[model samples]
Target: MRSLFGDLRGKIVGKNIKIVFPEGIDERVVRAAARLKFEGLVEPIILGEPAAVRNLLSSFGFADPGITIINPEDYPEYEEMKQKFVELRKGKATLEDADRLLHDVNYFGVMLVQLGLADGMVSGAIHSTAETVRPALQIIKTKPGISRTSGVFLMSRENTHERYIFADCAINIDPSAKELAEIAVNTAETARIFEFDPKVAMLSFSTMGSASAPQVEKVQEATKLAKEMAPDLALDGEMQFDAAFDEITAKIKAPFSPVSGQANIFIFPDLQSGNIGYKIAQRLGMFDAIGPVLQGLNKPVNDLSRGCSADDVYKLAIITAAQAVQE
Candidate 1:
C-alpha cells in the first residue's frame, strides 16, 4: 500500500511547523518529527524537556539537524509569556490561574503559537478532544470570518483517484441548523484544499420529504441555510446516501437536484451518524479515511487519534503545515 504521507508530502514540503507533545518525549512523537525533518516536509520543533526530548529521539534511531527543542521552564520569556497569557485571559484568569493553565499541555501549545514560535500546532495524543479544543478557542481563536470550528475527513480509494469528504464527525454532537450549515461550508472549503469542487450532499434518513420528522426538518433547514450562505455552491439535502451516490435513486427521487447523484462532500446530521457512516465507508469500501482534520481556528491545530500510526501523524502534519501562512 502506498503510504498516505507519500501523497500529501508533495503538497506540503518546506513548510515549518511546531508539534507539541504533551505526553513528553514519547518515541512516536520523536520518530515522526524526525521523519518529517528527514523528508524535508517541515521544520519540526519538539516542545518538552530538552534532555528527555534528545534522549528519546536518540533512542528512537532519529538524528536530524532540523529538530529543535524547548522546555517551558527554560523558555526565555516563560514568566512574560505567562503574564501575557493571564492578561489575555483578564476576565477569567489570575496570575495563579494562568500558572495553572500554563502547566497544561494544550495551553502551552497555544502559547507557543501565540508567541510566533510556530506557524501551526498539533497536539492531543494523551488529551481529550475538549481539552485540546478549549485552548484553541480561548487562546489561538478562530481565523477572521470563521465563526465556528468543525471536523473533516478526506476519504480516498486505492485503485481509483476518487476522494470523498465528510464532516463534523469528531466535533459537534447535534449542531443547530445554522451550525450544520457552517459545517457544510467549512467542509466544502476543506474539499477544495484537496482539489475537489465538492458537490455536497447534506445527508438524512429522509429523501426530499419522504419521511416527516424533526431530524429531517433539521437537515432541510440546514440545506436552505447553506444555499443562502453560499449561493454558488453545488449543494442539496435532506437526502439519503442512496440518493446522494446512486444515479438510479437520484433520478427517481431527486431528478431536478444537481448534487444528489454526485456528492463529493457528505455532511451528516449528527456525530453518531457521521462517525459511524465514515467508518463504514472506510472499512467496507476499503478507503483511507485521512483525518479528524480540525478546521476553523486562527492558526491550524490538530489532534491525533492516539491509535494513529506514525505515518498518520506525519501526513496530518503536512496538511496542517500547508494551512499555515508565512508572517
Candidate 2:
C-alpha cells in the first residue's frame, strides 16, 4: 500500500493539482487535506467556514496549516458560481434554485471543479453517496462517450502485491448489456491509469457456453460490445471466477480466450456480485480495497465510505489527484 501511494505521489508531485474536500469540518477530511498540502501532493481546497476549519486544524496540531478554506456564505464569487450553475443547468434551474443548491458544500465544491477552479473533488466522509454524486452529475456531468459514470476498486494484496480492478460495485444496480460494456471499457482505462495492462474478464456463473441462462447471455452480449468498443483491449467473457484467475482452470475452461488465465480487470455481471466479490476479497483474501473510485466523469469527483479513516481519505485524495494528472 505504501509503495502504491508512493508511485501515485511521484506522478502528481509538482503538478499543482487541486482537489476539493466538501466535508472540510470532518476530522478525517481535514487531517488528510493537511497531509496532502504538507506533502505538496496537491493543493486541497476545503469548503467550510474559515474559523471552524482553522479551529479544527489547530486541534489536529496544525497551528499554521496554509490550506485554502472557502465558506459558501461569505465566498466572494458566489454570484459568478451561481450564474455558471444556471448556465450549466440550461433552464433546469433558475437563479433562485442555483442559489439554494450552491450553498450546500457538495454542490459548491463540485461547482469549483466544473468551473475549473479546482482539478477534482472528494467527499462522502460525512455525506451520503447521493449527496456527493448528485451535484457532480448535475454540474460536471459524464464524459462525451460515456452515458453514465461507474465506480471501481483497485484491490491490492500487501504480501503478494497482486492487484486487480473490480467495477460497478458502487453504482448501477442492474445495468443493461450496453451499460455493462461501458463499465468494462471504463474499468480497463482505470486499470491502465493504475499501471496495469488490462486483460479484462466478463464474469458469470457459467464458463463460456457451459451453461445457458439470461444472466449468462447478458455477460456474453456485454463481452461482445466491450470488444467492439475497444478492439485493441484484451477482453474475453462469460467465464467463471476460477476460469478467469487460475491457469489450470482457464486451460480446461477457456484455453483460446485472450484474458482467460491472466485477467487483471474483472467486470461483474451486476452490482450485487461486484459489491460482494470485492468484499470477499477484502475480508477473506486479505486484499486492501482502495476505492469505489468514480470513473467516466468529465473531471474527477470521488466518494469515500462513511466509515473511512483519515488514512483512507489521504490515499483516496492521492488517487484522485493522480486521475487529474492523467486528465
Candidate 3:
C-alpha cells in the first residue's frame, strides 16, 4: 500500500490546484502557499484587505511571488453574493449577519468557491469548526448525490504504509440510523478518492448477536440502510472493532461477513466516539491522521480547528483541491 502522503503526491504532484485563504495573508499560510506553489502543487488566492495582507508579509520580512492577492473590499460581487447566501438560508440568517460574515476570512474563502472564483477553500485558524462549516452549508449546500455533509479522518501508518478512513468524526453529534448510513456512504466515497476499494465496517461495542442495545441496533439499522442506498458497495456493520479488523475474531464473531478483518473504512456511531478514536490512534499508534475532512458539499469547502498547525492547512488544502476536481 502507498503512504497517504505518497498518494497525495501522486494525485497532486503536478496539479495546479487553486486555494482560497480568507485571512488575506498570514506568515504560516503564506509559507505553505509558497511551498505548494514552488512544488507545482497549487495556485493560492488570498482574499482580504490587500494592504493589510502586504503589511503582514513585510512585517515578517518575507517576499513571496507565488501568492495572488484579492481585496474583499473591492470585490464587486461581495454584496450580491452575500445576499445570495442569505437567501439560501431561507430566513435562517439575516442579510446584515450574512454581510458581516463575508468580512470573515473563512466566509469569504468559501464564497469564492461558491462563485467559481476559486477551486477550493481552506480556513479555520481563527474560527471554530461550526463557524467554518455553517457558511458552506448556507451558501454552497450539498451536491446532487449528497443528502448531507459530514467529516472524515484519513489515518495512515508511516512504516507499513497502510491507510484507513473514519467518518462522522467532526460533525453530526449523535446521528440517527439514516444519518449514520449517510456517513458510511460518504466516507466510502472519500476512501475511493484515495484509490481504495472500500470495505466499510460500521463499528460498535457489540459483535453480531453477542450484545444488544438501542445504540447497537442503530448501527445495524444504519448498515441495512446504507446497503439499500449503495447496494453495489462492499459494506457491513454493527461489529466490534476486533471483528472488523481481527481475522480470527472476525471469523468467530461474524462468520458470514464479507468485510470481516478486511475493512478499511470505519464508520463510528457518533461524533464523540469517532473523534476520540482517531485521536487515540494518532497518539498511541503514532499514525498520521489527516482530517476532520469535509465531505458531501456541492463544492470543496473545508474547516480547520483553530488549534490546527500550518502543515495541517497545507495538506487539507490538497484535500480541498482534490474535492474540487471531484465536484
lDDT of each: 0.81, 0.92, 0.81
Per-residue lDDT tens digits for candidate 2, residues 133-249, read 899899999999899999999899978979899998898989999999999999999877778899999999999999999999999999999999999999998899999999999
TM-score of each: 0.93, 0.98, 0.91
Residue 237 CA error for candidate 3 (Å)?
A: 1.6
- The segments of candidate 1 whose C-alpha lies over 4 angstroms from its true place after superposition are 1-8, 17-22, 325-327
CA-RMSD of model 3: 2.3
Instruction: Give the lDDT of residue 103 in candidate 1.
Output: 78
Which 10-residue span in candidate 3 carries the lowest summed lDDT? 57-66
Cα lDDT tens digits, model 3, 40-94, are 7788897767777766666655465647888877887778988877776788878
User: Candidate 1 has what TM-score?
Assistant: 0.93
Q: What lDDT is reached at residue 78 by model 3?
A: 76
Off by over 4 Å in 3: 1-3, 13-15, 55-62, 86-95
Worst 10-residue lDDT window, candidate 1: 1-10
